[model samples]
Target chain A: MSDAKFHLYYWPGLPGRGEFVRLVLEEAGADWVDVGLLPESQGGGARAMMEALGQGAVPAYAPPVLKVGDLEIAQAPNICSYLGERFGLVPPDEAARLHARQFQLTVADVVAEAHDTHHPIAVMKTYEEQKEPAKAHAEVFRTQRIPKYLGYFERVLKANTRGGGRYLIGSDFSYPELGLFQIVEGLLYAFPNAMRRIASQVPGVMALRERIAERPRIAAYKSSKRAQPFNPKGIFRHYAELDEPNAMK
Target chain B: MSDAKFHLYYWPGLPGRGEFVRLVLEEAGADWVDVGLLPESQGGGARAMMEALGQGAVPAYAPPVLKVGDLEIAQAPNICSYLGERFGLVPPDEAARLHARQFQLTVADVVAEAHDTHHPIAVMKTYEEQKEPAKAHAEVFRTQRIPKYLGYFERVLKANTRGGGRYLIGSDFSYPELGLFQIVEGLLYAFPNAMRRIASQVPGVMALRERIAERPRIAAYKSSKRAQPFNPKGIFRHYAELDEPNAMK
Candidate 1:
């Protein structure tokens, strides 16, 4: 393996998309730094993160950017795929690698939808400013999207006879599996009532989630200070009204 | 180059995300077929596309899937990147390839946001049902997001001294440039007033749009019987109220 120290720039307080990149890094036991979490004096914080975004030859439009030596990459799924390939977290075959990236991109789609549940009308507006539309959007999300995505993943898990239904790609656990684990965790945190109600229909997905959480590196990271809790400021925000499962009926 | 015939599956009568892949295929002069547009008696239509999505070992969650021999790839950007690598539409350097994918993913983000401007509350609901929320969302998208994203791309164009500001990647034109062309076309179709109002701020992006359009293959495809007009059905839908330039003021 190439010995390269990696630098990650993302918002510090929230797990957000950065956590997706962090899972791969932690699982690979790779050398990396959460540059955004450091003090401003050491070239960290939001200002420094913003500067880092504009400094790269190929500048990132947003955060969750991965910088290794002179190479800078952005977009969470892209970063995860790059890191996955680098640390042997991706599959060996070309087709499987493409499938892994496809799965990660699908997970990203779900994540974006989840973020929209609380800010349906505008990203810049507060939840209070768009609470009515948020309620309407959250209802569809909780009722339709949640089950659809979970069911699709459950189907994928069951169809993966090559992995004995244990993984998304091959016999070995890969980055997309980590991504699945995170999405499930975030959904549970953001919409507990709805997710729990829908969980029975996706046993394969839930079982995989349990197995991922039990992975040694993942377990250690979750219990560590590095793991940030989901909050209103982040993508998957919890609002009691939005999580109500009565909408499903 | 491999002489594999590509089969594209997407919703017929709408360019949607499938056009991004089409631009690359057309530009490469690759042998491909839009299977969704074929007659149902010959194994085409929504039913066939839906079945195709579930039949592959690596099933796609949604369409705009590219099937080649035994390989079935989904997600527009993933398919474009794969095809780019296969047909020499991507940069030769590894770093440049990653950057092109980054730019493509960014374009996808904007496209998603643009879709939200017309369907903010629920994707299942019609725009008429959520017209008020869509109006609120579109205002922010037009006034804030349009300038932000276009301005960012303008900077990318300006900073790319390597390509002499003609492309987003290395000296050669690549798949991401095609993606940028599609997005600009989409925004103009969806929000003509806002796009025209903001045009003066992003000369490089607008100029790049012109160059991409004049590409012989792309020009031929755009004027051919295959090019589907943007309507209210697709991601970028035109609504007079949403396109009001007064929002920018």
Candidate 2:
């Protein structure tokens, strides 16, 4: 691994999308500094991060990227992959590694949908302006997409011959599972009734969430002041209209 | 290396998201099958590929994934990395490889926006329904996002001295650049006036796209009818409403 603490640039509050990376680092016992959280509140925070992210050959290619000296990386799942590879958290076998990545991407899809729950029209449009479409979009997501993705994950869990573990790959906690928990927790935060009713059907995923939450690092993170609650400002916004029962069903 | 011929599954009509993987395989002269284009009038062609694509985890993570036997890898840039590592397209040095990936992820971001041109709201919504919102989103992307991404890539080209030619990696076209060109071409197709104006300011990106477009393999592919036209069905739909020159300028 590269020397010095890996620097992470993300909005400090709300745990936000950046929390997925932070959670994993906590779990991995990685030495990483949350750049935006470094008391740069006077001015240079996400603005600096965004500006840095905007630089170079791949502009949309910034933030959520990790760096060690000259090596800069971006993309949420891609960052997870690099870290997972570094931590030995990823499987040694190629097939297993591929499976882990697949799980991560599926989670990202749901997370993106979760983001749409608040900003359904254009991200440029105020969330209040798009609130109606956001609610409608969230209904479809909760009713159709949630079950579809959860069911798929459940199937993968059942199919895992590695046999008997809450984590995706095995009994041990995998970062893939960590991301899944975050996704589910956020969905629940956004659509509590919908998640409760639907997730009750996906026992495998439900259990996976509980198990991941109970991890030592995660438990500490949650118990500690460091972890933030899901909010309207983040991807999984808790809008009462979007969370209405039978909204999607 | 692997016993099976690589199978790529994507929307057959346009060289949209999946084209990146196709370019890599073609450049390497790797034996591969494009499952989507194999006789749509009949059944089982695109369907089978689609089914297979949803198989396993990695590529199963998302489309434009490449399958090699038991391994189905996904995530556009990740797939590029895997193929690059295997095909010797990525740099052998670690720092360079990571940097190239960083650059490629930036390209992937632009490509995503290019897709957003057609369906800015949600993928499930029809173009007609989303046209109003899409206009604003497309306008922002064309004016703000395109130049930012292209300018960054130009910086990367300037930085990669050992990377040789105008190619993102220098000397030869890495698979990612081909995809990058497709993104630029798609943007140009959708927003000619915007691209024409923006491209004039970013000579490196403009020249790079032209150089990449004229490569022997790309030229051959373009002339051979394998290359498809950019259309409304794909990411960058050419709507006269979104391409306003004076407003953008």
Candidate 3:
């Protein structure tokens, strides 16, 4: 990459969508700062991040905004794609890069769906208030959406003769691989019962997940304090009621 | 810009996300085919589209897949970005292009939210089946989400001294401008009461909507047979109950 330092602004205390961008930054070994995690006295934390987001010449719609010098870009998948292109985390060819982005966007779709399982009626409302719809939404998500998405990825992996099933595009690990790894991890944590039931059917996806976790930089990052654990407040929350696998069979 | 004809695969009707890609193609004046609109004898319709989706080396997770020769790319925002880059429909500068994409992705977020307002509990289930939760979902969507998203876009427009409040980035109209137009049109159709109530608050967005519609190619495309009208089956559905302005006041 260039000598430019990357500054990432995300909500403090949760991985959420920000983790997708963080994965790329971690894997690329780029010089970066999680601005939201820094001390408030040093112009950090949520307030500083919000100020940066709102005050930029090109204002971002939400957090997980990436600032490389003066340019600010938002949307987690877009930021990851930008970082991937800059850090050589994406393939060299245009077609591969486009496909990688397409895959990453699909991962984003799954992440959004996972978030909706808890907040089915309204984002601002609590899960308890929407538990009825949440249950119904989680049912479809677990039995249908999860399998469909994971199955599609498994097929993509199996079809990637170029990567020999190790990556989403070409012969090397790219941002989409990292995205898949993160989504699989998030899904497992949120829906352990359903995920376990569906695991055998998507061996390729599981294998890729393990391979990504074993990567040296990723391993280090996972163990480091930078890698925040999934929580009930985040997108991928584990509600015992939502995690039932009775419908999977 | 090249002689290569683009083939777009989306569900056969109601505009939906495909219209976002269609707007780019129409504006670019690129030679393209809406494969889903063709007759069965000509290898058209949903079945053929599904076959192409499944058979492609780089399989798309969903439709609105753009095929240029052998390269297949999916995701509406991603496809729009690809077409924008190819047809010079995006800004020339890297930062401008990135910001355009960031804006387009935000538009996509709004579209997804609009879709959920009707089918809150599940996608596979009918709106009738999820009517209770859909009411709650639509309330928040109409009251909070609509204002929040449109307000954000309005701020972006006003901040663009470079575009002079005309375009999202730099000096010329880009894919995101078209996206903003499509979204405003969709939201107005989907939530007329709420949209009408909120219109005066976002004058810039409404004005941009008018300007985009007046553009020669876009104007022609809207009047053409290819431009499908909004219907209940599409993402932006008009449910009379859901579009109530009571919540707005």
Per-prediction TM-score: 0.96, 0.87, 0.97
- Model 1 backbone overlap count: 0
| Best of the two (1, 3) by DockQ | 3
Model 1, A166-226: lDDT tens digits are: 7787677888999999999999999998987899999989999999999999999999998
C-alpha lDDT of all candidate models, in order: 0.89, 0.71, 0.90
Q: For model 1 chain B, where is the 10-residue window of minimal lDDT? A: B1-10
All models, DockQ values? Answer: 0.80, 0.34, 0.85
Pairing residues by index, what is the TM-score of model 3?
A: 0.97
Over 4 Å off in model 2, which ranges? A1-4, A41-60, A164-167, A170-172, A246-249, B1-4, B40-44, B54-62, B159-173, B245-249
Model 2: how far residue B159 lies from native, Å = 4.3
Candidate 1 Cα misplacement greater than 4 A, ranges: A1-4, A245-249, B1-4, B245-249
Docking class of 1: high
True lDDT of residue B31, candidate 3: 90
Give me the candidate number with maximum DockQ: 3
Model 3: docking quality category: high
**Candidate number with greatest lDDT:** 3
Pick by lDDT: 2 or 3, better one? 3
